[model samples]
Target: MKDIRKYDLAIIGGGAAGLTTATHVKRCKDLSVIVISKDAHISYSECGIPFKLAGKVHDFDSLIVKTPDFFDKMGIDIELETEALSIDILNRKIELENCDILFDKLVIATGGKQRIPQPLQKYIGMDGIFTIQTLADGMKIESALLSAKTMVIIGAGAIGVETAAGIAKRGIDTTLINRGPAILSRLIDPDMAEIVSEFLKSIGVNLITGNIPDSIEGKERVENVLISGERIPADIVIISTGILPDVELAENAGISTGELGGIIVNEHLQAFVDGNFSTDIFAGGDCCEITDFITNKGTLVQLAPAARHMATIMANNICGKDTVLKPLLGPSIYVAGDLLIGSVGLTSKRARSEDIDVITGYATGVTKASYFPGSSDIHIKLIFSDDRLTGAQIIGKSGVKERIDSLAFMIKKKATIEEMLSIETCYAPPVSTVVDPLMYAIKDAFRKIKART
Candidate 1:
């Protein structure tokens, strides 16, 4: 009955969301927060793993934003290089590989492990097969790429696109293998993805869309991938298909789970333990689900930004501060070569899935004033559900991220086409046009919506 471990709050992961929640609670006298991370660093970015592989980051240290000393200064206890094995909620104890600890309020923030495709786990332990989720994964990929001259990446999402671009830029024979009909099949529309696909192709990378590898051809080491019954040579294989939530601890502790094995959480970010939030446990990040802003559907988007937003909500809720998390409007961006590809709100695919008759407008415009130097072509696509700006995408340079952020705010506020058309933005020749490209996108959408009505 002797006690050795105790904390007011125990965060189980040290990734983006975990760090945010810990930092938020650091100043509170009522909460003694400790973050248990398997990683050596406390607040490093996971999405930057691919960029590191491209020689963009000099080493693993450059990718780390903060050190162990930084967390100490913040008064947050950090247990680095410690792995949690399981959770015992009835006993209020977490069984780590090394020791056991007790927590008053538990935060399951283990973001996600890179998921190797199903039926491939037996082969995943094989050398040269990789999934980029952790800092370690990036190092492993970097080491492997030194010996590999050609690589094939599976998946067409943001990671796959970025990895392909990076590898091609490395002068490696890179090929992107996508099962979807288009790149970013679920995030961006076919037209916008086409822009991305074309960019990757232009950079001397082999691009394959609407196709898949039937099998890994190598019996010992990954030698080739069998697609269309033809064996394509490959020196390395990166499984970037997607990531699933890490729900092992939740399920074993008898916590309720949502669709796709995500930990079920209420508006207050509390777990649905004992049929209520009183279980004194909460979860977010890749481990939980959130309401998609446009469809009001439960979505399993495990992006870093989404996790950070959810972290703030979890912190407020855990501190007994009455707060609610707003639904996600799906604002996200991807970098492919020189293009800052991005989107917000809904996509054409999502609109049709809901049986909503939608009209869309597309314009290939400049990222800034046309007369400005370095002003490049930015193609925008806007989807509409009858005068309402449902979703939009931008494939451009210079202003892609900001425009996407602006569009995301509009979508979150439920601004109709009229409001979007007149959104007042600082216009300069270098950074923007007097007419923002998003406005052009929205005006185009308004016209299409009018025609549809």
Candidate 2:
């Protein structure tokens, strides 16, 4: 019989959430902390995979933030390539493959898993077909690309679009198959998505919209994708159909999960037990369903920043410091080719669907002075309910990511249109105009709101 190991805190999964929690908790108090990671490597940036594949980032090793040795120095025990087989929540024990671990407090940071369509599951691990969500997946895809000439990417989410751009940059003929009528439908409205679609096409990406991939047909490896009776030849296929929370382990332990398949946690990031919060167990990262600040409804915020923030709150609460996870505005940004796209809170399309009356203001301008040699076109769309800013989306080659972040903060603070318009933004001849685009955008929104009333 194996000996049962014990710890003050035991964390499952070692991505952003797990690592951040361990770091913060250890710093606050003396605690026996052990982090269980199923991955071959820990503390690597998952979002940097696309840029690394496209050669924008020179080395893959640079993506790793904390090595195993670093964690050791931080006084945290890490078990690499070790999986937690089961959880005995009532007994405060976890069953590993060969041993049992007991903990005073448990943190579930299992994150999410890539969702491959049922028809496409059989093609996984086969030649020419791949789903990327880890460093190893990126390495395998890069190795396979040496022999691939044409590629077909399913799903037009951020990863798929960014991957298409990377492949297109190498002059490979790439086709992006989007299940929805417009790409990034969840993040931006159709009009904003159209701008991105045009940008993708200009970079030589074949765009297919409103089509569902029916089957993957090949003798041994992926060779053709059949959609609506049309067979499209492909040398390689990458599926980025999004991810679902990795909640099986949590749910198996009697933890309550939401309708969206993510663990349901209270404002303190503790699991809901018998319709109440349990302080003994906590969950964060992509696994826990978070409250949308605007709607106050349970939603999954899967971005890295959201995970980090949740981790921080969980760490604080675990260390005898009362901290609560705040509602999220769901701000996100994506870079595709030379374009940077950003959005926060509700989209105009989403507001209308939710039956919320809203008006939008749109403005197009250059990132810098009109006479600046490298000045590029920028577009901003602001959605307002009455005189309060509800959401915003920005597309530009430069100066968009920070603006989206600013707008997200505004939404979080419930900033009115007047407040947004009066806030002074730094400007220079080469960097920005004396009058920021946001100022004009808010003014336009104000005018529209007046007309609507």
Candidate 3:
């Protein structure tokens, strides 16, 4: 039996990875589990931060999945208000802000930190400025929003779009600014991003694209926003730019970090550098690198699902199950008001950057039959190489993510366009057409390939 004094396991961070790690081990009903969470709330969804700020969650309490009391009932010790400041791998000791704990196994799911970017850093904590990375950040913004009027959001990722929608829905003057030519350019093509931008502008969102912010014109608190010599009046400026991995503690401990500033972990999610190894010391979540299943290269993908998947492997390995860690295909979905956006695999630009020859086919269609009452426009663009599905970009109001996920799976498995031609899907008059649009897009991509040949 593992000594009780030296706990069976230690899980840092209370996000999806850390929480699931403890819960999965708890099912074994043998080992003593201790979870050290720096945050006050446990199992709160970090992705739901923007929703919380928008009052979609109603209250801060509504965001938590479970409290310390809930953990008590499950026989898991949750150490809240406790910060794991540093890790002493050789000594197997975790130095907390106030105390020290020795552990038999350690899992560092410490998660990422909110960065406001180099150009946007000065305006941080300027009353109107905020980031939607953590629950604490969400709560802080929600409290500050009581006085904010005109809000300008920087960046055009999921967080930016979501926050823009929230502010627009709240009757505030909302403008979403992007440094690139289009929104979510990193994820999809400019044309696909145009679909989203159009929808945002149609729904009362001030869309600002292809411009860099000259300065955040604020005295002490945010008062005015400037971008490309244009001064827009603003009471708040939420810089939903992006996130940087929280590698400070890990770096200080001399753990290997990735090229994208995330900690470098192996297939087992073990952090290594300079022949140094920490037994049972694993890192996952946004704080770690994403091993692209296709290229076998470490990419920066901060998705909760990937983190949870990593946690599962880390848990089983800790339990002596010896599970293999699977790389991810980088599937993602977004909801901007009525529009549900989704995509998977590589974008066309990314594929070309890798020096892969590609053919693209696009189709603009409806989600349902023409007779349907509540149908929205469904646009699909597929990337094909050698008649195989290489990548895709999709934008629609409904059933967008489902098709993207399916297409992404096919791409990872190297499914041919002919394979997509044979796929049978559920169809209805009100919700779907007789022929799925994916089939049509694949058929179109095939025709283009034939013509080129």
Candidate 4:
């Protein structure tokens, strides 16, 4: 066989994690790097797609963080619209549809694909039906809105809620259908989700829970969604069910996958191949699973921050350095109209399901001083297992993200309820109250712990 095109590092996928790894490796060393992206456009923010669809972002192109030329300037090759066929581990080569390439090190960051239920698969490929996973997906939705007066979004996760808020803001009739008992069921508890549901209702958006899309009915495009026996009129339909890891390449290469269907990796982010850890192959991003900080369970966080952290650690080890990725707490925040929600670690519901003896405290206060201008109601819930802080959830228009970050740090440190009660918080009229809302939450949790003792 002839000599194949070679590189020091060949990265599959050009999403957040893959881009991070490529940039870090090139910046740290003189290694030749190339990134393969299945999408024609790479380096765009997937998280910002909903904002673009909602008109918060003026232009879709603005979401493109780094262009292909930018990466070329940084001494990295970006191959767009390329698909990886399979990996030949023994030969250290990857077979692409166009050509075969050899690499000293291989990084798999294939990201994720929007998971549509088998029942809903028949509705796809229609002009008015879409899934918001890429910039192209957003553009399609925007174009469809010209004739779409009503939309039915299935699945009330972050994407669904955000989309509903955005479409409703545009004076379009929007309805959010959630199969679970509450919106954001995976992120926040029902109590917190209740506030969100009410906010949605107050904004003139129809919020329906405990209902599933039975089917889509339309001629050439989506027209209505049938739930049970009710026929809900809709000009457009968005399926935001969830995402699943793109692990076909890894599995076809004879790589091991974890229980969660993501590529298995060690603490160093090295891929487990052939019954052992392989330094030459690494994986990260939504395509791999990590240990949950609180539950010690194999979980897929699928957050950009977590993926970036994993990429950094994987790159360091790939460059002849030693670095281990810590367990992920999956810190995340999302906006739904005026409400900002933040969550980290485990939820009280999840903790109890794990059979952990959890004590929770709930507190409500103003994000700013009571007398300050623009103060908003803030609700916090802190969970303690065996007197140690295990989880936190925050809901507010302002100061929610920052407070959740502090609580996440406490959980990472295994801080006790006593430590959390005394956490130092800055007080101000505009930014925070004299007593922070988190402090009140901790105090309540400590009181509950003491009472139990």
Off by over 4 Å in 4: 1-3
lDDT of 2 by residue, 72-91 (tens): 99899999899999999888
TM-score of 2: 0.98
Candidate 3 least-lDDT 10 residues: 1-10
User: How do the candidates rank by lDDT, highest first?
Assistant: 2, 4, 1, 3
lDDT of each: 0.81, 0.91, 0.80, 0.89
Backbone clashes in model 3? 0
Model 1, residue 28: what's the lDDT? Answer: 49
Ranking by TM-score: 2, 4, 3, 1
Which lDDT tens digits does candidate 4 get at residues 23-125? Answer: 9998888999989988979889888988887788889889999988899999998988899888999998989876888999999999999999899997789
The collision pairs in model 1 are none
Question: Model 3 over residues 171-201: C-alpha lDDT tens digits?
Answer: 8888888888889877788888888899999
Query: TM-scores, in order shown?
Result: 0.94, 0.98, 0.94, 0.97
- Tell me how candidate 3 scores on lDDT: 0.80
TM-score of 1: 0.94
| Clash pairs for candidate 2 | none
Model 1, runs deviating above 4 Å: 1-3, 424-426
